[model samples]
Target chain A: AQSVTQLDSQVPVFEEAPVELRCNYSSSVSVYLFWYVQYPNQGLQLLLKYLSGSTLVKGINGFEAEFNKSQTSFHLRKPSVHISDTAEYFCAVSVSGTYKYIFGTGTRLKVLA
Target chain B: GAGVSQSPRYKVAKRGQDVALRCDPISGHVSLFWYQQALGQGPEFLTYFQNEAQLDKSGLPSDRFFAERPEGSVSTLKIQRTQQEDSAVYLCASSFLAGAGELFFGEGSRLTVL
Candidate 1:
């Protein structure tokens, strides 16, 4: 079975500051990793995905994540954030042959002004 | 539609009442998925459909939860004898390809069981 763990339940950072949300996963087979963002009263939007090539993946809204196989981590990072960037971030893993995804609990990002 | 859309954005149902949620996937999308998101939690997979075929449904929590995508474009998830534990936001997503691709999600249908 595959599982995902988000080290932090909540992340607070001052405006214009850098932030990182930690995510780790455990799976027996090859997997595809993804980060999604959800604003208040909205569905999740794909931030970035790592299918093949490019361990460092860039996503919308100036967000990026690096897939570190050795560490089993895919941490999302932003050099700077805005108040609008506050949202719930999720890390998900989908195994090679499976059509479903296993998601971590989630990390609430609070971009303080 | 331009994106995945779900109907009845807000639904309040009695504990024992049955509820049906609908999802309209993006045009030409071949894969559709259902997920449940509890407050302060990430979305959990409920089922998957490749066109009219339900390729996977192992994520469904119980027999009370039923989903179908008969025509492949529109999908419906029906919950019978709903319980308070079932109160959560049900999200619908669609993708152009299967196995590996980004999914487009709808705002979701928030079901509140009382």
Candidate 2:
């Protein structure tokens, strides 16, 4: 079975500060990684995905993530974040041949002004 | 609407009652999915449909939960004799690709069992 782990339950950061949300996964077969953001009272939106090719995947809103195969981790990062960037971020994993997405517990990012 | 739309944004029902939530995916979409999102938790896969056929329903929790996409466009998730644990947000998503691609999600139908 495939599972995703997001250790941090909540993260608090000051505006314009660097931030990183950790994500780790365990799977027996090849897997795809994704990051989705959910604003308050809204549906989840795709931030970025890593299917294949380069590991350094960049997404909208100046966010990027590095996929480390050895560590089995795909942590999302941003050089500087804004107050508007505060939202609940989810890390999901999908098997190579299926559309099933196993999501983590989620990390709530709070940007303080 | 251009995006996925779900009916009854909020639903409240007593325990042991039956409830059905509807989802309308984007036009011409081939893949439709249902996910359950508990409060303070991430969304979990419930079932998946490719066109009019249900390809993967292994994620469904139990037989009490049923979903169908008859025409490959609109889907309905029905809960029989809903329990307190069934209180969660039901989200519907669709993708043009068959199996693997970005998913466009709906606002979700929040079910509250009292």
- For each candidate in turn, give its C-alpha RMSD to the true structure in angstroms: 0.9, 1.0
Q: What lDDT does model 1 reach? A: 0.94
Question: Model 1 in CAPRI terms: which quality?
Answer: medium
**Local accuracy of candidate 2 as per-residue lDDT tens digits, B32-68:** 9999999999998999999999999887899999999
lDDT of 1 by residue, B3-107 (tens): 889989999999999999999999999999999999988898999999999989988999999999989899999999999999999999999976578889999
Chain A superposition TM-score per model: 0.98, 0.98
Clash count, one per candidate: 0, 0
Worst 10 residues of 2 chain A by lDDT: A94-103
Candidate 2: docking tier? medium
Q: Each prediction's DockQ?
A: 0.77, 0.70
Off by over 4 Å in 2: none
lDDT of 2 by residue, A5-103 (tens): 999999999999999999999988898899999998788899999988999999999999999989999999999999999999999898876878889
iRMSD value for model 2: 1.3
